[model samples]
Target: MTILITGSTGLVGSRLLQRLLEAGYDCRAMVRGGRPKPAGAHAVEGDLFDTESLARAVEGVTAIIHLAAVFRTGDEALIWKSNFDGARNLMAAASAHAPHARFILASTSNVYDKSQARPGCESDAVAPTQAYPASKVAAERALCESGLTWTVVRFPFVYGDGDGHLEELPAHLLSANWHPAMRMSTIHHRDIATAMVLALDGKFDGHVVNIADDVPASMLDLIALSRGEMTASARPLAEPWAMQVDTALARSLGFRPTIRTVFHAAEQQLL
Candidate 1:
């Protein structure tokens, strides 16, 4: 079966593309910015904003792994356009061309309500406060309502593979009104890729799945990882269990993470 991967040049998508090829699946990589195509995969040059290119990207593919999104942009308009409108455009194309194709969307655990007293779950209410998470929520809703086989994999903070995304935590903590005692749910890039593959083949059609590591990382751990030193904060988490997501559903669906914790990241010197 052939699979089309959008954002194939990104951190998570790039790795997933390699893994999919290694698994002996025919792959089509939707690429832009003159990014070099994977050796064994066909490259379809496209932009999410370009409907024609999106149509070209989805032709004859049995599955579409959509990982392209705008998460760290300062422009609010760009965030909605890239996340919501992008998913809409792709779904429209897939509906017309590859109606029966499996569509797996990459969503975030941040879409969960942050004020709840317990860990986030698939059935929990969502209240996104920021543009990125809000856009993802909108995208998720669109895909769920679209007339196609779909699965939404909600990921927590994905790190590793030389990703410096967490490295900015030190500055963010200093500048933003973030609570130091707040814990973070995390998953390695390998695990996220595995989840995507699982979602592609698993019996989770028309459902949402949460993918995360076994344990939650404290803000102190993140600060120490980002910076060379660690410091304590007297402020406690808004709710004791906030940001700790429940992965029981994903685990039951046969997703066992090879890297169970951020400590593994330290072992590989990825932090």
Candidate 2:
């Protein structure tokens, strides 16, 4: 079966492409511009905003893993165009070219309310305050209502494999005041790849799955991961709160995390 992957050069997508090839799936990497394609996969040049490019990319693929999104941006227009408009374009292409193709979207757990005391579940109502999460919510709605087989996998602070995603915490903290006690759910890149592939089964269609580790990580822990050590700090931006996600639904569908925590990542020097 052929699978087309968007954002194939990104942190999760790059590793996912390698994993898919190793598992013997015929893969197509949909790349923008001169980005180098994965060695074993077929290459298709495309931009999410370009309808012609999207049409070519969507043709004849058995499945389309939609991972292209904009995060960490203050520009609302760019965020909406990339995350929401891009998704609509791709979904439209899939509908026209490959109507029976399985569609998998990569989403974030930040769509949930920050004040929720328990972990966010798939059935809970989404309340996205930021432009990034709001765009994803719009994308999810489009995919679900598009009359296609689809799955939405919500990720929470994925880290590992020297991706330097964790290293950006210092800069993130600089822009917003965060308390050291703030906590968030997390997952490893390896596990994310695993979940994406497993989601291809027809049984998971129309489901929203949360992919995360068993335990949540604190802001201090993230800072430690960022600096490679722990330190004390008193910041007004952070609140003593947590936003955990329930992954039980995903686990029921045969999803198991290979890297259970960021500490394991540090041990393997992936951080």
Candidate 3:
């Protein structure tokens, strides 16, 4: 089967491409100019905003793993265009070219309310406040309402070696010298890639799954695991804190990872 992955050079996309190639699947990657393509995947150079290029990328592909988007801080308008509008363009292309292709959207757990009940389920109402989360919600809603087969996976604090987002956590903890005993969820990149492939191959369809590790950790626990100490003034983020995800959906699909493993993996990457 031919699987097309957007943002093929980004952290999750790159890892997913590696796994797809190892599994002997025909993989096509969408990349920006000047970026090198994964060795085994077909590289298509184009911007997500470019409709013609997006259509070309989707043409004849069996499935699409939509991972491309503006993730970090940026101008509000630019972020919306890249994250929301880009998703719209990709969906349009997918509809026209490969309507039956299983489209997997990489969403975030940030869509849920910050202070949610433990083990948040897929059916819970989304409450995204930040710009990034808002854009992701918009993209997710578009795909769900679109008359196409799609699966949305909501990731909760994925961490792995060379992850840019995880790298920043240490800085925040150090600069603020603050920590709280708040439970948090996380997953390894390898597990995420594995789950994505499984979702594409398995009986799962049109479902929003929350992917996370087996255990949750407090901020203090994570700091200690990283071999760092919290200052006396360290404090936890206010109420409406991020809660754990209900990975029961993911587990039913046969994917699991231990929190100890994830924490150690992140420690190796951070320190």
Write one digit per residue (lDDT tens) for candidate 2, span 1-271: 8999998888889888998899899999999887887788999999988889989998999999988888867899999999999999999999998998999999999898877657789998986879999999999999999998999999998788778888888776756555677778898888888888788766467899999877778878888778844445665533233467888998898888887788877887776
Sort by TM-score, best first: what order?
1, 2, 3
The regions of model 2 sitting more than 4 angstroms off are 228-241
The model with the greater lDDT, 1 or 2, is 2
**Predicted structure 3: lDDT:** 0.78
Q: What is the C-alpha lDDT profile of model 1 across 1-271, one tens digit per residue? A: 8899998888788878888888888999998857788678999998887878888889999999999998776999999999999999999999998999999999888887777768998998787879999999999999989989999998888888777878767767656556667788999888887787788785667789998888899877877877634566685556666677888888888888888889887887755
What lDDT is reached at residue 13 by model 1?
A: 85
In order, the Cα lDDT scores of the candidates are 0.85, 0.85, 0.78
Q: Each candidate's TM vs. the true structure?
A: 0.93, 0.91, 0.88
Clash-forming residue pairs, model 3:
114-240, 115-240, 178-234
Lowest lDDT sum, 10 consecutive residues, model 1, at 228-237
Give the lDDT of residue 62 in candidate 1: 95
Candidate 1 structure, TM-score to reference = 0.93
**In TM-score terms, which candidate is top?**
1
Ranking by lDDT: 2, 1, 3
Better of 1 and 3 by lDDT: 1
Candidate 2 residue pairs in clash (backbone atoms < 3 Å): 177-237, 178-237, 178-238, 179-237, 179-238
Two-way TM-score contest, 1 vs 2, winner: 1
